[model samples]
Target: MKLLLKNTRTLTENGEFEACDVLIVENMVQTISSFIEIEDVDRIIDCQERLLVPGFIDVHIHLREPGGEHKETIKTGTKAAARGGFTTVCAMPNTNPVPDKLETVQQLLERIKNDALVRVLPYAAITKGLKGEELTNIDQLSKLDIFGFTDDGVGIQAADAMYRAMQLAAQNGKAIVAHCEDNSIVYGGVVHDGAVSKRLDLPGIPSLSESVQIARDVLLAEATGCHYHVCHVSTKESVRVIRDAKKAGIKVTAEVTPHHLLLSEDAIEQDDANFKMNPPLRSKEDQDALLEGLLEGTIDFIATDHAPHSSDEKAQGMLHAPFGIVGLETAFPLLYTYLVKQNKITLKQLVDWLTIKPASIFGLPYGKLAANVVADLTLIDVEREMNIDKHTFYSKGKNTPFHNWNVTGVPVLTICDGEIVYEEDFHV
Candidate 1:
């Protein structure tokens, strides 16, 4: 089917918005110009002067399938991604039977082929069963259609194990996406080790717990020449280390979550599990550093880290509740409202962080809105303001801290590969 998106302001290469129309014909962007003669088009969408940009790409998300479908599935998770303006998302390997072997990776591919509404790229495990004891067959897994390797939920604890994994990843020409945390320093903490934890009398997770591991990995990556990507960075020290690594010409990249950028440990309220997450929200100083890193290009991009858990698991409160909160549905709106509207960053920069930057890091072909590129696009109503209600989310997880927050810039239409996967009812 041929689809034409009209009356929209599209983002340009020069970081300016230009009025143009996009034409998609059966999976690729056929044309993008000021005016295209409409003929034989199956559908024409009136965008009403809204913004049309490349679809968002999230490099970190947990589609709890193959084992934790009760929390989320490929179908539901992709639907949530579509509603959030993301056309592609990399699924973490922390599923029931981890995608450590070829068979497990194949299983995930089959499920994504059958169930995903948007594109789903699976990451193979860095360690066997993600136990950090044995390295997986990176050479064999790299041959499969997988997106690098990572043990997302758990950090690789042993330096020798991590060094070996980096060596293997370097040999295979693949990245080792790391969840940097030193277990020895964690000490059963649930929140950031700062004034909030002290005042609340809660176990504190020290900032060094995250930065120490990042510091070690930076050296290993420098030594082995591996493309090391840090996951969900939350500390000021980690940002500084990453900056220095890049200055020293190390092949290192990092991503910051919306929560880490927007909130801090001071936002945590008593007994609210929604505020809990791994590498827990750091102090205000750390948050400021993360923002600066993003603006200065030390942070590569923004990812949702869209983890989901059962309601009962989250209802256990701060002490016992699992770390994570659903992010896919709120990432864009929250960022646009808080960052762009507050003059912290330009709209183009925000869009690039969600689009081209991630695509460049992952070497994917779905982040540009040009001819011959895949028709992965999103139209957002930047003027619309709506309260965030988790009940309205497509994913089963209703564990977000942004509840009742009024935010602008809601996604109204998402088209993936020439198909209209999600469209909001503007009449409502």
Candidate 2:
């Protein structure tokens, strides 16, 4: 089918255009010109001055399948991704059965292919059952279109095991997404070890707990020559360590969640369990440093850790509750409000981080508007505004702290691989 997207602000690698037209023939971009007079177009979406950028690719997300379906599932989670402008998302392997062995990974791939609305790329577990004691069959899984390998929910606590995993990953030409938390230092700590934790009388998770792990992983990556990716990075000290590692020419990349970029420990004063998440919100100093790193290109990507939990579980006290918030449905809105609207970054920069950069990092082929490239695109109404209603979310989990926040620039349509996966009718 032919799809023509006209009168849109198209974001490309070169730059952003005021108004242009993109012609998608079947599943690839046929033409991208200011004026493309064409007939027989199956769909002509009048973007009406909205931004028409490449569909985003999220490097981190938890599609709680194979278990934890009560929290989320591949079908529900990818629906959330479609609404949030993500055409593709890499799923963490920390599932119920845990995608450790080749069979588990294959099963996940088959399920995603059969059920998901958007592209679902599963990351194979680096260790068997993510136990961190034995390595998984990384090479066999890598041959099956697997995204990469990661023990996402838990970092490999043992250095020797981590190094072996890295060596195996390097040999298989796959990346290792590091969770970057040192469990040895983590002892009953809930939030960031800071003034707010002290004031709230909550257990504090120290910065070194993350930095120490990052420091170790950097050296390991340097030694093994593997592509190392830090997931949901939340500390200034960790940023410095990553910056230094990059300068030394190590293949290291890191991502910061919108929560880390937008909110800080001050929200903990709300004393709401919804504010709880792993690698909890940190200090103003750390937040500023993260923004700086993002601007300076030290930070590789902006991903929403996007973990979801049951409302009942979240309603428990912060100490007893699960750590996470649903993000796939709200990431773009939050970033547009906090980053683009505030003039902190250009829409092009945001698109780059969300689209091109992530695709490049994962070695996927969906982030460019070129002939023969897959037609995965997101259309946004820059002026659209709405109060987030958890009841309307496609995600099963409603654990977001931004439930009532008024947000602007919501996605109007999501197109994946020449299919109209999601479309929002303009309210009359």
Candidate 3:
């Protein structure tokens, strides 16, 4: 069936907004012009001058399927992702039976084939069971349809092990997505080591724990000439190191979460676990540096790291709770309201960060709205203001700190592969 979305404002190839109509035939964008002639179209959606952009892609998200379904499953998590205007999400390898072996990767693929609503790409584990001792079968796993290699919940502590992994990835034409943390330096701290930790008398996680490892990985990346991607970068010094590495022509790219760009440790007024996360929120100076890095293109893109834990687990207060919070449901609204509205970055820049940047980095082919491309699109109401309510979330994990925060920019319709996967009924 053919679908025509009419009277929408779209970002052009030159980063300017223009009025246009897009026509999707089957699973490809058939036409995109000011006036698409309606001929035998099965459906016509009046976009009402809303913003139409490429479907957002989140490269780092934990679906927690095959093992930890109590927190979130592929079905529920992909629904949440579609509601947030994401059409594709890369699933982390930290599942029950890690995707280290070919059988494990096939197991994940079978689950995605049966349960996924949006496109789900799984990452194979770098180490066997993510223990950081033995390497996984990267050569065989890369032959499958996996995205890359990562041991997301834990970092690769051994430098020689990481170098071997990078060499393997380089030979197989794949990336090594790293969760850079030297466990020896972490010292059992929960939150960022700063004034907030000092005031609350809580154990603090120092900035060195993140930057020091990043410094190590970039040198390894430069040595191996492999595509090394840093996940959820949260410190100012990390940004500086990444910037210098890029200048020196290292094949290194990094991403920053919205929480790191918007909120600081000062936002942790109480001992709530929702404010707690791995690579915990840093000081205001760190936040400013992250924002600057994003604007200057030092930071490659934005990923939610959308990890969801059970309510019972998060109710244990800040110190006892696990490190993570749900972000697939609120990432776009929060960033659009806070960053774009404040004039820190233009809407086009924000769209590129969420859409094209990550797609380009991961070598995916589904981030543009041009003719002959795959018809993955999202229509957003940028003027709509609503308070975030966790109860209304499609995700099982309602663990979020932005509840009741009034924000503009809601996704009204999401289309993946020319199919209407999600639609918000404004009239109702």
Give the clash total for candidate 2. Answer: 0
Worst 10 residues of 1 by lDDT: 419-428
TM-score on alpha carbons, each prediction = 0.99, 0.97, 0.99
Give Cα-based local distance difference scores for all models. Answer: 0.93, 0.88, 0.93
Report the lDDT tens digits of candidate 2 across residue range 1-428: 89998888876556646678889988888888888888888878877878888898898999999898999989999999999999989899889899888777778888998999998888888888888898988778888878888998787899999999899899989999999888888877889898988888889889888999999999999999999999988989999999999999999999999889998887776568888898989999999999999988789889999898898998887889988898998999989988899999887888888988988877889887666789999999889998999989999999988888998989988989978888988533
**Residues 39-127, candidate 1, lDDT per residue (tens digit)?**
79998887888999889999999999989998999999999999999999999999989999999999899999999999998999999
Model 2: ten consecutive residues of lowest lDDT = 10-19
With candidate 1 superimposed using the best TM-score fit, by how many Å does residue 117's alpha carbon deviate from the native?
Answer: 0.6
- Tens-digit lDDT string for candidate 3 (202-315): 899999989999899999999999999999999999999999999999999999998898899999998899998999999999999999999998999999999999999999
Off by over 4 Å in 1: none
TM-score between candidate 2 and the true structure:
0.97
